[model samples]
Target: MAQLQTAVSMIYPPRCTTCGDLVESDFGLCGPCWRETAFLGGAICDACGVPLTSGGKDGVFHCDTCMQDPPPWVQGRAAVIYRGNGRKLVLALKHGDRQELARPAGVWMANMVRNLVSKDTLVVPVPLHWSRLLRRRYNQSALLGAEVAKNLGVSFCPDALLRRVRTPSLEGLSHEARMVALEKAITPHPKRGHRLDGKPILLVDDVMTSGATLKACTNACFDAGSGPVRILTLARAVKEA
Candidate 1:
């Protein structure tokens, strides 16, 4: 079985989905490419987990945006900041058919969720609309959700929330526009209320930009009777001027 797998790999030449370089091992990222990722560290927002630019006087760190209006999710954690190699990796995974890249990224996200979430929490991925899922061939958030659930010994529910409409890409939108767009895009699953009663939820996603998407999803989950939602993502984009 090992030899057959190796033979298949050699014929296929497994490559880093993020960088398109031949993978030196099964780890997905080449050594140097791995070093380029800027994982979030040190003081971070207690609500959204974006690295705080300055510490708060009360020792309670908060990003300026979070202080203005806390997101619907109770808290969030991200594996890395969305810049440099982290941005490239997420884009590749989402649009470049770099499905294999999800492995390492998912594993890292799973570890983070495991540490933060309680054992009984249910894991749910922020869902993609049917149109987007068809175009992408996979929901990156669901892929991460599955890995997180497996490693953490929690139940993974990919259908707990639904995207009711396909909105325009948020790439160039202002934060307010992104929030409005997401508000019109998502809704609760009909049956999720039955499944979510009294359950804490861990919401998984690929990357967080302004957190509008996650916040929308969290509201849907609450409508479906879920308890407080905590968000986990592979990357978080820094606030830009």
Candidate 2:
């Protein structure tokens, strides 16, 4: 049966989830499309995990924004920079319902966090408002979080956090406006059943844009007795304001 399915799929090859081009490989992305993504390189910014250029003087590596007001999360890691094919891939997984992309994306993120986090860590996804979830059919962050937890052998808590507000689309907003929009957008689940008390948490999200969303979610996690919060994402948009 498996071989027959493979033969049928080969006859009608599915398009690459990222580029929408005919996929030649079973892995879902065309070779050229896959080769275009540049995963985070060495010496990344500790705050947001954007790749850093070599410094001349002090041997320090810091993105310009991280040098200013630092982010609230203890550590952040991203599988790739959000540009070119990377951005397209993330959008497909998120809005296009090509969720199969989550498997590899989540594994890549989990491997990045394996040494940094432990098996005991709990996985929490940045929550989406109910209205948004209803429109989207599924929460991409939750799907990614589930895969990451499965790969890391950690507990996955999908409802550990909840969103309190349904903010407008964040595109074209200033950094301050984005922060304000996310402020108080997240809160702890009221059921009190999924206890995060004294447990470390790894927050999963599809992309790390301005990080306002992650910061708000992490603050709520800390308030609910979760330990230091670390973040992992499929992509990290360059911080250019």
Candidate 3:
């Protein structure tokens, strides 16, 4: 296996996932791409995982948006802010059919949410409607979630949540409108829903914008008796002030 891998590497050297530049490792960004990416660090909100200006007095923190409209999940985290190379990586994985990006993205998410994991934690991905799934040929969130579960050594329920309604594109919609469009659009899967009962759930996604989708997924888990749900995403879209 090692010899075959070496032969393959020699034949086709590994390149950066973002830029086409060669990198020493596989499934990663080049140095320039790495530095340009807005990987989240320092203080962040407990509810939405948006970067905060400062840490909280008591170790728990939430951004103003989260404070005003709290999310359904108990905690949240993100690997990067949605901009520059971070956004590029998310879009590549989500729409460019770059499925290999899931490995590194999932590892990043697992590391970000490491403190939240437990023996009974079940990793789940936000679902796509059947129509979208058929059109896209894959649910990017599920790939990320599966990798996260593998890295974390936890159980994964890819179908724990089902999208009952296919809503239109959420772009250009106000947060309120997005919420209305997603209301009850997601629910616990009848057959797989039982796996979520009383288990701590780690909800995974590629990007979090208005968070309406993640909120709906969290509520579905709650409806199925899921315990203390937490969310993790590859990137979080930060709104301009």
**Model 2 per-residue lDDT at 10:** 80
Models 1 onward score TM values of 0.87, 0.87, 0.97
| lDDT of all predictions | 0.82, 0.84, 0.91
Q: Model 2 compared with the native: what TM-score?
A: 0.87
The residue ranges of model 3 lying beyond 4 angstroms of the native Cα positions read none
**Where is model 1 more than 4 Å wrong at Cα?**
1-17, 20-24, 56-60
Residue lDDT tens for model 2, 1-241: 9899898888877887666788765546677877888678678876688887765246446677877877777788998889997888789888888888888788888988888888789999988899999999889999999999999999999989999899888888887898899888888998852577788989999998888788888889888888788999999998554
* Cα lDDT tens digits for candidate 1, 1-241: 9999989888888676556699866657777777888888678887787887686767658888887887888778898889989999788888888777777887777766566788889988989999988888899998888887887888888888889888889888988999888875787777764676678999999998878888888888887778789999999888665
**Which candidate would rank higher by lDDT, 2 or 3?**
3
Tens digits of per-residue lDDT, candidate 3, 1-241, equal 9999999999999999888899998887889988998988778898888999875868878898888888888999999999989888888898999999999898888999887789789999999999999999999999999999999999998999999999999998998999999999999998999999999999999999999889889989999999799999999999877
**How much is the lDDT of residue 168 in candidate 3?**
92
When 1 and 3 are scored with TM-score, the better candidate is 3
Candidate 3 differs from the real structure by a C-alpha RMSD in angstroms, to one decimal, of 1.1
Candidate 2 residue 124 Cα shift, in angstroms, is: 0.7
Model 3 residue 30 distance off true place after TM-score fit, in angstroms: 0.9
